[model samples]
Target: MIRAVLFDLDDTLLRLNLTAFIARYVAGASRLLASVARTTPVALGVPYVRAFLAMDAQDREDSLTNEQLFNKTMLEACGIPLDDPVIADLMTYYEERIVPGFSSGVVAARPVPGAREAIEAVHDAGLICALATNPTFSLACDRARMGWAGVDEKDFALVSTYSNSTRCKPSTRYYQEFANQLGVRLEECLMVGNDAVRDIVRDGCGLRTAYVGHGRPRGAVWRGPMERLARELPDLVARLDEQDA
Candidate 1:
């Protein structure tokens, strides 16, 4: 019976052009870290990008926290040995500059039209709300983006982050952990996101799911834009409840 609704943040609640955000952030990050390195930002960009990719790859397998894995890989990519003082500086740049910069300055984000109303619809239906964002970034990063998207953090019962989650999106374990955290079965929760493959791990995770756009549900739970979701969710929730009963 639709006890919870987990919403994806990027491209769903907020419109963040991933390519654009990445370019801006990489530039900002290089400059931020270059103070410690006596080299060109472009050279730093190469390994910075590589390390981030490595972290994403590691996120799926190891139980290491995202910060732990990122620290190890980034230090290795930079040719800095563990326990080097420079590792501290890199981490400082990440925590103090990189992630926060995305929200206010490094990248521009826009709220998805009607997302707030859709969230409200979910609430009115007496379902719990959660942010099932990919666990690649810290909670602060997701919270900042959520603020721009007009989603109040206070409203969510669970918000996934790198420190809290072991797996990233597209992995069934990610959704499984999310539902486990909420203490609900997959069928009792509905996941809504823009990315078809990453958000709805239906065949893998067996969770009810929804997509946003012209894309049909296509073995998903629901499909429509935010405006339509705002209108459809309450009725849909009622129908699901009846079916479950």
Candidate 2:
């Protein structure tokens, strides 16, 4: 039986224009780092962008956490030492101030239709509900985005963040890690998300996927919008569990 429901944050539970958010986020970060690094935002953005993209290259067996890898790559690219005190200040300012600021004005992050109800459905079925967003940012940033999604951190049993996760999404190890956190077999979890590549898994991780993206993608055992999921998830979960059994 499926004991947990792992929901992706950005385009799944949250109606986020991830591309736009990333662009704005980069701009904001560049502006902030420019002042500290004594360089123009345009000049600093090059290395910043490089470091950001480096986070996407997941290792099957990585020693460094996503945050650690980001810090290492960023410091190397920027010629900043690992022990630099400014590093702490930069991270603190970014997560506490800059990331929270992204919620309003241009960043348009909001809840997906019926997202809250879908979460409620998971709980009603007595399943473990986790916010399985890609762990590229701090937990504070995740919580800030959660506010935009009209969800609370308290709602989830596990909220994946850069501090806690070793890998990024689309990696089967990332999926397996969350299952491990819930103390359940990977096969006992249903990953619900809108990304065709990140949400669906064909590899032998034993995790199942229910895609809520634009089209029916390959490897998804189920497909529907959040509204349908809200109404039907309990029954659907039971059916999937029974089928597997």
Candidate 3:
């Protein structure tokens, strides 16, 4: 019997043009850091950004954390020797300025039409709701994204952020941890998100899974509308209700 629903944030509950957000943030951060760094904005900034992204891509593929890969990639990309004072300053700048500035763009998130209604229906049924976003960001960052997606922090029984989780999505360990936190059996949870590879695959961990379908990346199977999502939950609940009976 399903007792919990977990939702992925970006491109799932919230629609985002990742390329646009990244470009705008990089440009803004580069300019902001230029005067202080005493270098051409792109010269210092773009390489660091590229390095960061590279590290992220590598981390996703290798199951490493962002911090584990960031500094080494940055040092290698900049060729500035690992212990350079400039590298230290750049890291400081990124953490202090760039991350927060980029996060500000998330405030522009608009809910996928009907997503709020679907979530409301699930909540009304007395099932637990969770925001199971990849735990690579702070709670403040997750809250900002949730605000953009039209989900309040209050809506979730559990909100998984990097500060609060030791693992990330696509890892069954993370899903299990979330289930444990919510006091729900893995088989009694539904993992809902846009990514088939990350979200739907959580079914392997014993959770029922729903692919959000909209906003799928290239070559992904399309599911359908948010209203269909809303419509489908009752059937799932009915099945679980029968199992309980």
Alpha carbon deviation, residue 10, candidate 3 (Å):
1.8
All candidates: TM-score: 0.84, 0.93, 0.69
lDDT of 1 at 189: 85
lDDT (CA) per prediction: 0.76, 0.83, 0.67
For residue 229, give model 3's deviation from the true position in Å.
2.0
Q: Say which prediction, candidate 1 or candidate 2, comes out ahead on lDDT.
A: 2
Compose the digit string of candidate 2's lDDT tens values, residues 1-245.
89999999998988877777777877877787777778788876777677667777765456777777777887888865433677666867787776877865566787888999999999888899999998887888888889889999999999998777778888887888888888998899999988888887777878888889898787888898989989989888889978998
lDDT of 1 by residue, 86-164 (tens): 7565755575555655655435688999899988888887889999988876676676678778887898999998777
Reference-based TM-score, model 3: 0.69
Off by over 4 Å in 2: 59-61, 81-86
Candidate 1, residue 77: lDDT: 78
Model 3 spans with C-alpha error above 4 angstroms = 26-108, 214-223, 240-245
Give one clash count per candidate, in the order shown. Answer: 0, 0, 0
